[model samples]
Target: MAAMLTQFEDLAADNTSGATELIQRILALCESGAMGNTYNEIREGLNLLEDAHSSMPSLHTVIQILKSEFLPGLKNADDLEQSLRYIVSLQKILEESGAQIAEKFLSVLERPTRILTISRSSTVISALKKAHKANKLSHLYVLEARPAYEGWRTVRDCSAAGISSTLMVDAAMGEAVQTAEAVVIGADSVSSDGYLLNKTGTLPLAICASEFGLPLYVLCDSLKFSPQTRRDVTIDEHPDSEVIEKEESDAFKVWNRYFEWVPINYVEAFITERGVFPPEELEALSTEETAADE
Candidate 1:
């Protein structure tokens, strides 16, 4: 149990893994009977994850399920077994959602098209690979997301999948946008005001894409949508050491914000497991969901 908790702690500290991947691992941990034997223990485990990755709405969804649906039912050994089965079912659902999102995303692409994207999203990568497989994707341009540099992982995955891709610095988004036919990105969360809360470079990428009249699509499942407004959302600031080796001094101060908001007007569409929709439609959907919950 101690070892399992330590492993989960390390996973929480990881900044590179996408939210989908992290949620899957969290479900696996719960199914392994390693989270804890009692409700408090499991709750603590979930709390650790929430604290570490507050920006991930999908992860918060998983945590909510475990807390509201599973934790309350964990009374006996038989109950624990039932909870594990529930976790397994949820994991399968998430997997299917990912595949569905990829399929929907592929349907929107023009044949032999080039795509430009920033940061690393498991869902976006899955869709790009699917498009490549279908012969609809000709080339991919990846922006090397700084701080965590997760774009390197995206390029590696693209290469392994035999997809033609180019890696460029985040600042080269203006140039990359001009070369690609469209922009596709992944969202950490879609804010209540219909803005995208994602990697720090996404706002600039969106600006470039919009200025060039290139369609910018956000690929994510509905689980990534948050009921919180932009002001309510927490934007994590990583260590200053990630930006510079030198400590803060009278000479300079390093600011290392990991995420930022991109205006909804910059996005042309949002491709999700359910279907593709425009920003206005998503805004209505978000409003409906919030009202229903209230």
Candidate 2:
């Protein structure tokens, strides 16, 4: 399963033949209980496919639709990365207008232009690094997304080059969101209507940011924007084996999902290389897309 998912991502990175079918297979693996070596793998696989498909915008539109509605469930991110490295090698090919959309979206985040900073990890943090120079990121409050704690890596990478950064419990996001000028978190997938499904705590944070009137920015490469829309984005749920031995708890009904949906209303803006827009803006974007097709 791990090997298969890796192949799928590689296909995605190249934007070559078999990518769509390969992606379908990868999703199947994720849902098939091959969770052990698939957790983090699917995210990478999806990212590559999303990025690659971005260049072929029309194709991406289709891919996004499929991904949003239903993504396979995988468990154990570490085990899933074997194939990730393969696709990582193909990054350059995957970026295109999709990457631009991602960058443009993130740039708009600096309202006062430069004050408080945002924190993120995984693909999003990587996307931010590409657009903002380390020094440019200097006062941003980049938090370490936890459990996976990939945010530590973001801090290290961003700070090493001079981006002032920090690490915090995923639980601390509320306080951070309340004080930060903008919450520029990354996105794993976006539903049409502009809802975001990302790391577990994202939904609540978006709400908190909304409650506090803070800007909640979703930084994603346009490619990361799955072809799928609202009804398309499906939550990937993992097995209880991840939490307990199944022997440990008498009532072990663990419903663990790697990502979640942040309703459009909760999202302040979407940061893609294309530039940021208010959540309502997605409605307009959708309309434009429809009109163009017509």
Candidate 3:
């Protein structure tokens, strides 16, 4: 249990990984905990994870599944084995969902297309790789997500995959959008009101894409869809030192927020593992999912 808690703590402190990667790590931690710990200890570890990453609805969904469906049945070693199997199955499903979403997104693009994207999204990187393999990708424009500079990881991944990519500053989003054929990004969460919560620069990128009449695609799995509205979500503020080296003076204030909400009206479509959905259709989809859970 102590080892499991340490793993969860490490995951919580990780700001470099994308949402999909984080969810995958959460499942892995849960699987390890379920195998070695008692039901109560696993539950305690999960509670710690939940408190640490409360903003991630997808992570919460995985926790909810374990709590309501699997944990209750953990009465013996056999039950623990069954729970481990289920967790492994969930991990497999998540892995497949990324590929499925990539396929759907690639189908909508023209061959030899240039894509502009912000931040480091594992899902977007996978889709980009698939597109490159299929001869659909020409070039990629990656915005160097500020403060954390997560986009550097994306550029590195693209280079390793032999995909042509250019790294630009976040402020150059307008130029990037105008130069690219389309804008593709990943979402942290999609609210019931059809708003997208993602990396801080996403809103500006969407606006630029809209101004240039380019399609803005959000590539994510259905697990990112949240029952909460934008009002209910809290945007995380990072350390001020990330923005400036000096301490805050009385004259100036440094605001280092890492996430922001993008109005869905600017988006062309949401390409998910299930299918492509327009912004307007999201409300009904959220409603259906919420009803199913109830």
Candidate 4:
């Protein structure tokens, strides 16, 4: 995930060579057959590239042409270069507007306010870092997103960047929410109905945020949008080993679900590269797509 974001960062200056090299690297990774999450990585890269090229109409036109010309007949994964180009082209339409979306989030922040968040997302982290740099962030409250403990990494990174943050057990989220000004999260996927599928524990945090009347902001690029609805999306069950050790086996079953669903109404707004959008707007967007698909 970090590597994919790094590739996007290389395109910060709108360098075509940088974008091409990133695509080449992505293709190489795809060919290596080691990418456990190729589709998401592609979306992330595409989101970044789209942001970099948002102001360049000629480049945007090139992206559209690439998608229109290459994507339709993509039959298999073996067509690696074609697939990469197709992804880049698809990004032009599907990726969010860009880092400007993150900038839009700064309006909701007040100086010296505590923001609650969970897990690690390149997009969410980048927004928080930006807020910190602007001196709008006073503190960050992170839940120790477990089975993987990705939140620990978030806390560590925040500390390294000189942002004061606290790491708490997942169970402490409700208590933390009481004092937090708002909650921010990253979506693994946003369903057709505008529901967010994110790391486990997000739903409860969202519920808590809603209960307290605190805003819950979802930071993500539009490429995270998936065609599936909540019921249609397959929830992956991770290995029990992720939650338990080999020596700690118990007769009781352990379910290690890596993600959870948070309904759209629980979110205050979606912070995207295009800008902040209400759930109604997302629903409208989805409705338009459904109509177009017919």
TM of each candidate vs. truth: 0.93, 0.60, 0.93, 0.68
List model 3 lDDT by residue over 1-294, tens digit each: 576667777877887777789888877777766766667777776777677655567777788888887787566776777788888898999999999999998889867899989889999999999999999999999999998999999999997999999999998888898799999999988887768888888988888888889999999999998878889876677786788777445467779888888999998999999889999888777777779979
Ranking by lDDT: 3, 1, 4, 2
lDDT value for candidate 4?
0.68
Cα RMSD, model 3: 2.0
Clashes of each: 0, 27, 0, 1
Give the range of the ten consecutive residues with the poorest summed lDDT in model 3: 244-253
Q: How accurate is candidate 2 locally (lDDT)?
A: 0.53
User: Considering lDDT, which of the candidate structures 2 and 3 is the better prediction for this target?
Assistant: 3
Write out the backbone clash pairs for model 3: none
Ranking by TM-score: 1, 3, 4, 2
Deviation (Å) of 175 in candidate 2: 2.4
Which window of ten consecutive residues has the lowest lDDT sum in model 2? Answer: 14-23
| Candidate 4 local lDDT, 51-131, one digit each (tens) | 553322223333444344543324345665665555455455332443565588887776657899988775677778889
Whose lDDT is higher: candidate 1's or candidate 4's? 1
As for candidate 4, its clashing pairs are: 98-273
Higher-lDDT candidate of 1 and 2? 1
Backbone-clash count (model 4): 1
